[model samples]
Target: MPPAATTNLGYTPPDGGWGWAVVLGAFISIGFSYAFPKSLTIYFKEIQEYFSISYSEIAWVSSVMLASMYAGGPVSSVLVNRYGSRPVVLVGGVMVSAAMVLASFGTTIMHLYLCIGVIGGLGLAFNLQPALTIIGTYFHVKRPLANGLAMTGSPVVLSTLAPLNQFLFDSFGWRGSFLLLGSIVLNCCVAGALMRPVRKTVQLKPNTEPQEIVETAIVDSRGQLSNVQTDKRKTESQAWLHKFVDVSLFRHRGFLIYLVGNVVMFFGFFAPVVFLAPYAKHQGFDEYSAAYLLSIFALVDMFIRPATGFIGNTKWIRPRIQYFFSFAVAYSGVCHLLCPLAPGYVGLVVYAVFFGLAFGMVSALLFEVLMDLVGAHRFSSAVGLVTIIECGPVLLGPPLSGALVDIFGDYKYMYYACGVFMLVPGIFFFIMHYYNYKKLDEEQRQSLAVEMKTSEEAEQLKTSSDDETDGRTH
Candidate 1:
């Protein structure tokens, strides 16, 4: 029989030296995983013209890629659980690099779908889940700060990649640019190498009975248990998928509230950004000015993410991050709702600034909130479940909004729809979270009462025993 496992309920974090390095590694891996897909838009227009496809048709490239990235989450989670982050991430880096290199040779749009959309996306899924998982393993006390720093990778990479992609396209065209990007993406492998396992030492009790000696095992962050157990209690636990991902989260009051609100919020979340440049052109702005709007957004977004991360990591904000996230979502909705009121270039620029801040705040908090709810051990699975469910909104969002444009011949309605979608979720989150906090407080109070009662009874018993012994001796 294996040794009994040591269950540390409230784990104190280790010291900071190597852990910060791990954060830096995560920063690189996560940045590439997220930013690579968005940057590929530089090639989209060229590909569309080459293939003689409509806007919707070309948009499928991004849609399929995003869907595949989300859909591949389970596979990545399972693999990360089975193996470890280091090897899984290394394999992911190779996969995405190979996908991009092969995609450069594609003669048809189908080839791009298979290579870039599916294979490259799977690679990103691998990079993303493991990187996020490792951060949790290494830091607990400073988790918010770690998450904030790691998430900054997105905007930072985006700011760099957008222009780099453009420069590459200008210099080498789509095919050559892909080849170059493939080489650059291989840096993920190096980042993966830095995610070494956190080694822990376990001490055994001295002079234990031989019978009490049991097999010893170690469990890692991914929930792979190593130790053996004798006389283990049998209980009905959820199945593997449910255990890892907690599909039961749907039944959880807090998770349900978050899920419903997010579903509505996402419908409008990405669409405005998708149409922002086109809307600028529709207002008779020059093409360069319209394109520069994205640059402005990206620049502001890049700075805002790290700043928000720092803010979210604060003592006041970290414990109540859900509220912060809710506010950010609502704020984003307000920005979008006010977008149509932007009568000219200056108005649009103002809108872009607010939109950038809102987007950054939400993005930084998105997965962090999920991890806070489900825990780091189950985060991979949770993300997988959330992303797959969210795939529908992500894929349908831009197109549905575009259809609204087709119908009304104006973008205001789309903006309004998005605004309401975002606003409602924020409000739902605020109310639901208030209730959740109250319930948790009540539970904590009950727990404290029970503990105090038990302690008092033990103290009284000890006093009685001492008095009885003294009287008998006298």
Candidate 2:
């Protein structure tokens, strides 16, 4: 058991200090975690040509990578919980670097799947969960801002690596590019090194008199509760896999709402981006110009995330961040719905700007809102659960959208489908969250009433005992 301290009521965090440094580390880690897969597209054309594979088959490389990243989330979470964030993130960095280097030697698509998809994806999963978890440990008052800064890594890395990958591919071919990229990815190890464990001093409140106060002990990692404490221990323990991530999150009301909404939302989320360049190319734009569209989108997305985080950190917005996220999701859907109406390149540019904004807003707040709902104690498990469940949509969204194009030979219908898919979840989340807030308020009120009643009853008993002692003395 850990040593106890006096608990203080109504404590507010100072919100800034070394926490900002931690956010910087998170920025690098999260940037690579999100951007690596998307940036690899610079090699896709070359890969397809070299292997003489179809576009759909080549796309599976990224699809498998993304699916494995999400699928491996629980394993990463369990490791983070057991060993702390530093070691897990460092190990993950090594894994990603090694995967890239090994992929340089791949002779078949299957080899790429094994090295780049499975190994690299798992490395990213390790980076992602620990980075997000550590931010919660370091900052509460400025958490939104910190989260915003960290999440900006996605767009920043995408914008930087896309062109860099192009340069590498131009200079050395795919194999050489992979070798160099492996070295570049090793910077994640430097980021991981900066993620030192936070040491916190927790204070407990003292009793008024000399009565024994039974404190129920709970151990936390950083500031978050360890997963073992959250789960009920059995006399004879179950297997490690079942114990790793708490599957019971499926039954949690808030988690269920979040899960259902996200599952639906993801179907539309990535598909637009996947087809954005291809869609532009289909409309007679040159390859370079088409690729520039993604760079434009990513640059805009990079700027928007930090700006949204600042807004979310504001007094007016921070408390109600879930609503903001829901609005963003709905807004994205609206953008997709409007994409089919754009007649030319200029119109596509306009759509890209709005799309960038909506996407940035959603991505910035996605995990922030989850942490808000579940609290830090359950964040690791919650993230694990969310990612594992969302794997299907993440893997399927693009292919399914591609099929729409195959059917109609136009990208507009696919955009429309994605728009509706995104919009419905936004609406569902808005309604469900409103209800959830109401239920939560009611529960809080009831709990307060019960606490007050219990306190009053104890006071009465003490007064009666004092009176009886006085009577006996008289």
Candidate 3:
């Protein structure tokens, strides 16, 4: 294919229609990617007994899995950028299935860590980055809604997997459960197959035009067109590095703001969820009752995500989405901060309702804000870069929260810390985003002024030449 044709193939997104099918695929892949680790908690007690391990050691299984998933972001991003989402996700599905099958036969904690933690985590990384990235390719106007629907996969899968895992544990034991889970996870491959690559076309206007003009268009894939020049000085090493990671994102003001806020936000994010069941159990609830709390949270979360998405897509919110996201983060923080004050089961349930709403709203807008900041073309790289750095806090958050629990001999202090962590970042994002918005407006006005001046000069020069030609003819 010609260069123009190839460049054009990547320019425009369908924004809807079959894009909904792509959203369905993302929902499946992302659902499994996030839900699997949490669901595996049901097997931890058995695994601990079998391995004769401490709670901390057993806990490392999920921690390592999450860490590896975040750490593998760049590699997955590179693969997705190079080849596309379908193939990478298919391979990820296979890897996750294989990892689970292998874990079913493992004899040691180390074996589980290697199979379920590292390998499985990498597989999820592959599943996650592409699923998020492809949505940006398929939709723009309705993207928030698409993202909201796709993110509901987390709650839906968590709700299903939690109970399914318990039943499987009762029926078949942990080993047999792992085997069955492996089969179930292979459905990600089916979802991957559904993620049809969205091809866009950007056509270049004829060279006879005064300056190069580009337009987003649709054309036959095989059509021939002219070549566009690109920087040729970069060597093999630079090309490879740039292909996978866009290091320049470090300089991006909005992206930096988002990244810092997320790093802080994540420190509090997963820990609360991790400790929720244990906290409820500590409060003298039975295992079933404690687990039911998560169900309530997930159920509320499921409805709110789509609603948040619809609200975000509106003219009122989409333009100021960063503020909306900040509010969600702060809302979650306040809920956690007051969690300790909850009188009893009813209070916790009330807290769960608010937490679910806050969590859903944040999750729905998280990537949308990133996409808004960086645009689609750079979002893949931006996410990859973001995940790699954010992995530290994600890995440490639970342990640090656990230490607070150890110190206080209660979960309340940990909850307090998480609330602070989230709140600070929420406020930071709000203030910084306001300044960023003002700066962006100023920059746009300055650029417009420069363009107007250049156009006027060009017009005046052309008119002077026309008058001189008429005088010579006279």
Candidate 4:
């Protein structure tokens, strides 16, 4: 037989039931974590003018915030492993609210970076990782759909907040807007309170179940004998950090593939959205009209995210979902590459619709694909590891794209860069997934052949023993 699998404390999750409730909580947390940064772009232009900063310098506000969120992934993961999701999320909510409130009083650019970027970003990290991790614990068969539904929070919040931020900026200016945004973010705490932890009874293997024993004794590798009662407990030799972070995932082939693809993918992911508003203004659309484009993108995204999830969960799609994700990425890239062709208000509206569809498809599938590759059991550690590694790309992507804007004095080149970044990774994923699937199939067949041979051997031995016993009796 193949080597026995490692023993772990098993909790066979209920797959549904209260899982829907957890999804609701995830929606709220994830919505804020992603949308908050994007929505803050509304303040970027005014803030840039007020502080006499360049586009790239103002871009760093979101960049620093996103980087901190990604960098804090491991810490967030460790805390979730120790304390669970509710407390982490609640604390994250408080930090975000306080950060926004503090940011409103800022007199210098550094203050905004420290308050909204670092502290607020760290708070968002706490909210984000745990919410995603707990979903793995709560659902298995329905996980893709669950993830999709939860992720719709991004579009819904984005659509609402895009216009809301603009209105706040117009009515009360950026200062009052920041203060109000703080109060709005505090509702994440209320959402966290709803993420009640689920407890399931541990399952025991048949061979390891309690049984009668006689003359209980144990022998060590050194040939030393000891009373079984005293030596019954097995010791784990893994380091403390390994227990929490699961560093071995670095060696997992599928995880490595996912990680590399995601790193490249993120290098262009947020740049287009970050510049979308400014690009419109550069084209002479008024502020409300520019903000309206985001709402349009978000409205389509809101519907598509859930639909994509449902589609992904179907048997035909789930088996080949990696390819689906690859296609989504490529489609998004193609949209960006062709964006320059679109002219005037109608052209931009069409671009927003298509962009929304493509963006939503990728976002809905992102975590679902990761969980499929790494599995629910290891997903917490996997997400933590992924976020930290991906920080470099996530942090630098927008600012680098902004620099391209500064160089060309137009947004078209920035879109071109993002297109290439996304397309290359999409193609890479498709090819790698093809080979990986073939290897997995071969391994499964080999395992099945071994099981069949072992079964036949046992049957033959039993028949021979029965014949011998009959002969002896005769």
Q: Best candidate per lDDT, number? A: 3
Strongest candidate by TM-score: 3
Residue-level lDDT tens digits of model 2 in 1-474: 111111121333335677777788899999999899988977999899999999778888888888999998888889987887888889989999999999999999989999999999999999999999888877676778889999999888887897899899899999999999999998888888888877674645576433558997666565446455445454235445445776667778888999999999999999899899989999999998887788778878999999998898888777677899899999999999999898799899998889999999999999988988877667888898889889999999888999999999999999999999999999999999999989988998999898788778788889999999999999
lDDT of 1 by residue, 40-124 (tens): 9888999899888876677677778777887888788888778878998999999999999999999889899899989998999
State, as a TM-score between 0 and 1, how close model 2 is to the true structure. Answer: 0.90
lDDT of 2 at 41: 78
**Ranked by TM-score, top first:** 3, 2, 1, 4
**lDDT of candidate model 3 versus the reference:** 0.89
lDDT of 2 at 47: 95
RMSD of each: 7.6, 6.8, 7.5, 5.4
Once fitted onto the true fold, the runs of candidate 3 whose alpha carbons sit more than 4 angstroms away are 1-10, 201-209, 212-240
What's the candidate order when arranged by decreasing lDDT?
A: 3, 4, 2, 1
lDDT of 4 by residue, 39-137 (tens): 898899999999999977887888899899999999998989889889999999999999999999999999999999999999999999988988877
Q: Which whole-number lDDT from 0 to 100 does residue 374 have in model 3?
A: 89
Residue 297 lDDT (model 4): 83
Q: Give per-residue CA lDDT, model 3, range 13-114, as digits (tens).
A: 777878999999999999998889988988999999998999889989898998999999999989999999999999999999999999999999999999
The superposed Cα distance between candidate 4 and the true structure at residue 37, in angstroms, equals 1.6
What does the lDDT come to for candidate 2? 0.86
Weakest lDDT window of 10 consecutive positions for candidate 1: 1-10
